[model samples]
Target: MLPRVLAIAGSDSGGGAGIQADIKTITLLGAYAATAVTAITVQNSLGVAAVHLVPPDIVAAQVRAVLTDIGADAVKIGMLGHDATIDAVADALADFAGPVVLDPVMVAKGGAFLLAPEAVGLLSARLLPMAAVVTPNVPELEALAGTQVEDEADLLLAAQELLESGARAVLAKGGHLPGDGDEVVDWLASHEGNRRFASPRMATRHTHGTGCTLASAVAAGLAKGLPLERAVAEARAYVAGALAHAPGLGAGHGPLGHGWTLASG
Candidate 1:
């Protein structure tokens, strides 16, 4: 049987991030994808222009409807635009008996703020505890930890702090750090242990939805019964492959080549 995974996230009109990316990544990994959109974004490869939040009740209804019927083996969450949306999602997932992958999507690829400032507290208090794994880039990590993470050592500290904050596990992305080398390292820390997944960073501006893709891929692996460490390793390889074969599109950061495996097959 195919593993069923649900994505509770925003909709990206550009089809590169949010629900779109989650769907693509999940399906690419041989999982059945379902979605409950919490918001709609007017965006493109260049940037996000505006966001229209979905009503909290509607969000709850969608989640309940999906859980009642199709049922999820895992859930991938991204881009909750407000405190209310965060609260609604947390409430909806309170009883979910599946792995939950949380991508702390505070900003867009073009530097647009996707999450409200007030939502941070709600996320920390209500949502973090429910996550099987919380993935955050450097800026999001800093926002969550209330400190500056200057180097790899700081990243490890930040991951531990976030775990202390509430997350069961944390994946601290190292893409935004200033470095002269072509390598990027992401740390995965959990109660079990800690490990780093590093890759030669692709020298392309076409990484609009890498975070979403990575988180969803992890969720897919978990849905398929892989342990957390193995899942993270597989997800890292998937993202690296996608980045390496990015389909050059748009005038700015472009979408990843989610169909790379299909081509290879």
Candidate 2:
């Protein structure tokens, strides 16, 4: 049977991120893809112009319909437009037995807000409890932890604060950290301890959906029964390959070649 990964996210008109990226990443990784769209955006590689939110009940219904039938081996949650959507999504996944990966998508790359500030607290309260892993970049990590993460030291401290939110693990991505170094490091904080995954930075602007791709790739790995550490490792490697093979499409941040993994590595 094919591993199923249900991605709960917004729809990107540009197909660079959100449901589009999730489905592409999951499918390229040899997993089945499902989605519960929370919003629709008039967005492209350049920026997001407008957003139209879907009803919370409707989003929940999609979740119920997919999970109750096809069944997901793992769930990757991306954007929740507001508190209502967060609550609805949480309620829908209340009884799901699979691992859940939460990507706290607060804003789009083009400076558009996807998650309302008020809803952050609701997500921390309602959804964090059920998530096996929460993936946040430097900005989202700072927002969720309510502190300045200047370096790994500050990030570890802030990640400690998020651990109180009931999530089993938090992967604090350091992609935006200020440094002239040629490499980036991501920290994973869990009950066991902290581990670092570092990679040489690739000079490229085709990283519009890097976060979405990474989260979905991790979900795909989890859906295939890979352990957390191994999943993260594979996801990082996969994203690196995608970045390396980025097609450089679009005027702004270009979309990655998600099919790169399927090509000869």
Candidate 3:
């Protein structure tokens, strides 16, 4: 049977992020993809213009409908728009036995808030505890860890502290690190130890859904029974390839080449 990975997130009307990105990444990684959209955004590669949130109960209902019936081997979570939505997700997944990868999507690439400020506290206290792995970009990391992760030491320290908050592990992405280097480094911190993954950063503006794609790819790997470290490594490599081969679209930042793996095969 193909690994089943479910994405519970918002809808990116542009097909570059959120549920669209999750579906593309999961399917390309050889996993069955299912989704429960928590919100819908009028967005494209350029940026978000408006967002309409689905009711919390409705979100819970969607999650329950999928988890109890079709079921999921692993879950990728992103952009729960409100506090109630966060609670709804937490309530619905309380008994999930499979791995959960949470992408704490706070801000969008064009500087829009995907998550409410009040909802951030609820998510940190509730959902973070439930996640098997939490993927956060540098700014998101600083927000969660309450300290700037500017260097390797800061990266490990903040990640370790955040992991202790309840998540089994945290992937602190270093893609936004400065110096215009050709490579990007990500630090994975867990109870066991820390792992560093380095890859050449493809210089492109088509990195719209990288965080969502990476999390979903890791979810697919976990659904296939790959270990956590291996899953993250595979996700990083996959994202790099996607970046390298992005099919430039829209007037602004284009979407990654999510279909590359499928085309290669």
lDDT of each residue in 120-155, candidate 2, tens digit only: 889988988788899999889998988998886787
For every model in order, what is the number of clashing pairs? 0, 0, 0
Worst lDDT 10-window in candidate 1: 177-186
lDDT of 3 by residue, 1-265 (tens): 8899989999999999999999999999999998899999999988999999999999999999998889999999999988999999999999999999999999999999998877777898998988999999988888887788777678778899898777789999988766687788899999999998888767688999999999999999999999999999999889888988899998898889998887787
Pairs of residues clashing in candidate 3: none
TM agreement with the true structure for every prediction? 0.98, 0.98, 0.98
Candidate 1 segments whose C-alpha is farther than 4 A from its true place: none
In angstroms, the error of model 2 at 109 is 1.0
Task: List, residue by residue over 123-213, the lDDT tens digit for candidate 1.
Answer: 9899899899999999999999888988888998999999888889999999998776689989999988899888897789999899999
Instruction: Give candidate 2 regions above 4 Å deviation.
Output: none
Can you give the lDDT of residue 144 in candidate 1?
Answer: 92
